[model samples]
Target chain A: MALLEARAELDVIVWPEDRACERSWLMENVVGATGVIVMFPEKVNTELLDKAGPSLKVVSTVSVGYEHIDLKAAAQHNLKVGYTPDVLTDAVADLSVMLALMAGRNGGIGVDLVQKGQWPNFSWSPFALCGPQLSTTAASQTRKIGFLGFGRIAQATLARLVPFGITHCLYSSNPSSPPNYARDAALAKQHNLRAVSKVDIDELARESDVLFVLAPGGSGTYHVVNEAVLKKMKRTSILVNASRGTLVDSDALAKALREGWIWGAGLDVVEGEPNVTIDHPLVKEPRCVILPHIGSATLETRGEMTTRAAQNVIAAILGEEMPSQVDLSTVL
Target chain B: MALLEARAELDVIVWPEDRACERSWLMENVVGATGVIVMFPEKVNTELLDKAGPSLKVVSTVSVGYEHIDLKAAAQHNLKVGYTPDVLTDAVADLSVMLALMAGRNGGIGVDLVQKGQWPNFSWSPFALCGPQLSTTAASQTRKIGFLGFGRIAQATLARLVPFGITHCLYSSNPSSPPNYARDAALAKQHNLRAVSKVDIDELARESDVLFVLAPGGSGTYHVVNEAVLKKMKRTSILVNASRGTLVDSDALAKALREGWIWGAGLDVVEGEPNVTIDHPLVKEPRCVILPHIGSATLETRGEMTTRAAQNVIAAILGEEMPSQVDLSTVL
Candidate 1:
């Protein structure tokens, strides 16, 4: 709200909705705004850009993922787009590991058993609630960790995995960057890892004891961990998606869990989330630990994200370099 | 089962009951056995040891903790006690970190929000269900991690915390051991810790952003983390108990969680567990994430523990050195 107060020098209009900003209100308001700040719900498309009438210089979003933003439209209008990124990396990575452990260790089902008042029905058994151990032990044979996209979030996650005695690391990045074995070996040494290397999707699926989905959302990465990839995964493996819901096909994951293709899944996001109700397939799966799309819901992370977004909008309006301007050339 | 089968020549009378071996049944069966392989439920006392007459040389338990074994009685009878130790360390450590993340990130409440269908009732607000993050972010203040007792499990848990950007470390061991500044300094440097030192219970309680209770269970440790210690904890701190239920006072913890003495608690073990039913005060607390006593429930860990117990029994029966024999000289 301070950002809105700061914009009183310029004729600035703020969306007055308690919920997500209304499409019609955004459309009408864009007619004369020099700067606009939004979140995940708003879509910056050509129609909105056209309505701005050349007055709009910047669109700042208070979120890390910008798949909802129409990059092509922003590029066409020569608009500087800014989104919060690194501020949220730690919070998201923390949640990602939480999901991995929850799924692998039967956290959701165990809690449900306690919450539903069914714990006293039986005595403690040796194998009750037992699942694959996440940490390496004296008895452990292999400890392999994998990632769908080896970016900042994935690397942060890998750093967490090092002290757990994770031996091998495998990941797949975007097709543009070729494998750099030397660089990866250096990274491995830095983290005291056995090995860290790029691998193809199939190898990543088959070898990973725990596979994390940390890719961006959009057509390029949508449903990347679908039926085929799910099938290739070890039966003891766990799938965690803290990146975006679109990266993992929920239906495929549900079926895989039910059929024992993988041991379990921990998901923070679902495709078309908020709309994903109690009746959703992933929600109903006993093994799937589903959160309500709160990967960066930490107070510190959210506060930083909002402050950065406001600053980016302020900078863009003042004809200064935006703090975190999205590179539209590669994205579009 | 294979371990039991391996002892073809010994007159090993295995407990045939699927449930916890009844006290009456155990008393009847120990009449002629030279050794007994028991679990947490069985009490090794004067009565059972008396029943076994002079034949009982050893009581091997398939658990890491021997709280159930009446140490005084065993020591009085000159009985050798063997327990499975190091094998289950990783399993417990894995669960400890899981509980820390779960409590700090509101994994329990988030899962319930989905299962209870309350997610659709409200819009995604900026701070909905957000608790203190487990990992130290770039914006994080001094991240202090504390341990009530610095044992193997606690040290293993600390290793997991290293990559989470933990800055300070504090721990309290048994009062008898003198603090070695030089050794502590070396350890601090080895783990890249900002500081690591043995502190008193009061300082440990007050300083830790995330406090872990990994002390042994006994009268000395019972209610060690009581209301006073809970009160000293930071309002944003989290308490994790992966060691013993008795180490934490359940009533005090439930009160702390309700009154917001600290942020939240992740408890894998609770006082009078298995009996910690649906209506238990700790279970009912929204901030308390409770799990049944399954800290060492991983299939691999459990198998190794059982094998070790059997091996201890075999070693004791043959008058050989036990694999993980308890130092009864000190216990007595």
Candidate 2:
């Protein structure tokens, strides 16, 4: 609606109303187009660019991830790309913490028992329905939080845990970059944490009471949480993935839950999500709490993302610099 | 198990194994018993005191709420009562925050959609499955957190929300007690909040983005969140009850959800819970996420509670000061 209202002198075309725009419809409509907006389901490659007939100036997506867009081809086609990033960091970070709480507290199992009409017959005992406590208790005075990626969202999550009496923090980032000890010390001081250090993936898995997977998704980062990492994690620890599906191996997670290798898992994105069925291995596991890829599904965040995408397109069409234009060279 | 281990020379009578000891069995075995340990299901009353025949010196309950116990009767009978309070505070506070997050987001609805194998058929749109975000977003800068009771647990919960960028706080405590402006100012300064003040139930409902019920359970607080108060709430607000079922009216909440008086609810305790079935109004409402009275259900917290109960009973039996002896006068 914002895009439609903002298009003053320009003619705007929409792929006939559906859940998503079909590729054939987009291909047939892209001829001589000045700007295009796409979602995760659409691919922007050489073929789509060729169909646009060298007249296309901008491609804007209302998402933080641009994996669906072929950045190398876009650079070759001399196109400007825009994506909504920082706007969604808080929304996704909030979901990440919520998933951690759900997974650690047997939320899915409890909901099932109530929905199945079994709660009436369920008996309460001192230890019934007990799970590992997420907050620091007198019995467990120290807590360690670990992150697979220590980017903006991950840091936001760590900041939230500070009030939960978390004692230490450990994270793993891109190994290609050197550890920033100065930055780590500064963050520890800012948060009043006992320690904040970077470590290898295995150490992170072993020491963390809750391990969060917030790394980007792609072949290079795929299956980072595999059988070996799952096995190395504490038996009482929880796993939370809110970033992307492919970062975690579904089979490995299923097997881990079956054998009690780890306590539980909470996932917002799954390996083949939106196609996940009741028969899915993780779905069958009572402790695995799954959401339908709604990490950034907050009305405020989505509105901002759509409005930003529209601004990017409008600015490019007016021959002004796009607000959030992506440097395709760096992406490639 | 802790009680058994600690009882050195005392004759410990065990009830024939069951989920809960029957009243008949307890009456039959409690004859001339010097000390009694009970859970939520067991009521320590005048008749039970008569059954014990002046030998009862202590009645220790492994819970924070002792509504089942007759405090006035215990005071008349010259009995020392013990209840675990501070030990479970962190655990309950953690769950309170979890409930708020789950309710503000569409956690229960999302889980149902996924579990029913409807995700594949469900189409993703920009605003689909969108709910009000729990955290402060750029679009919505200020957030107000409200509490039904601003006691220890409620204050702990408020501490956890500080990192979520919550700006203001409003809480309604006991009307009999005057507002403590000094304490509220100190708390506001400590949390870096814009303001912290007392408000009436209606104003709290209207202004809070999320309202948490953390008051004690009794006739005094019963139905405090009835239809009139629910009607005053924001359509985008959420209601979370981790305190007691009686604080909220189940039928009224169901109707509120059905009519969109509030966005959603996450309840750990429903009115007449454990008896809640699929036919129950709140259980049947997709927006109401119910958990079966597991606010203090953590292995660490429960273990601490049991141990504390044991210590209290043993201390009273040995004529020593019980660690958590309840003043029946104050309770009454």
In candidate 1, list every pair of residues with a backbone clash: none
Query: Tens digit of lDDT per residue, candidate 1, span A1-332?
Result: 67657676766576665567778988988887888888887888888889987888899998988887888889888899999989988888888888988888889988888887767765665676889988887768668999999988999999898888888999998988899889899988998787898999999999999999998988899899999999999999999999888888888998999899999999888888777787888888999998887888887888888889988988988999888989988755
Instruction: Estimate, for each residue in B50-126, the C-alpha lDDT of model 1 and write its tens digit.
Output: 89888888999989899999888889888889999989888888889999989988899999888777666646656
TM-score of 1: 0.95
User: Which tens-of-lDDT digit does each residue in B1-332 have in candidate 2?
Assistant: 65667677788887656466788999999999999999987888899988998899999999999988999999888999999999999989999888888887788888888988998887777888899998888888999999999988999999999999999999998998999999999999999999999999989999999999999999999999999999999999999999999999999999999999999999999878678888999988888888988899998999999999988989999999999988876755
- Candidate 1 C-alpha error for residue B125, in Å: 2.1
Retained true contacts (fraction), each candidate: 0.66, 0.83
Candidate 2 displacement at residue A21 in angstroms? 2.7
Error of 1 at A94 (Å): 1.3
Q: Evaluate all candidate structures by whole-model CA lDDT and list the values in order.
A: 0.87, 0.90
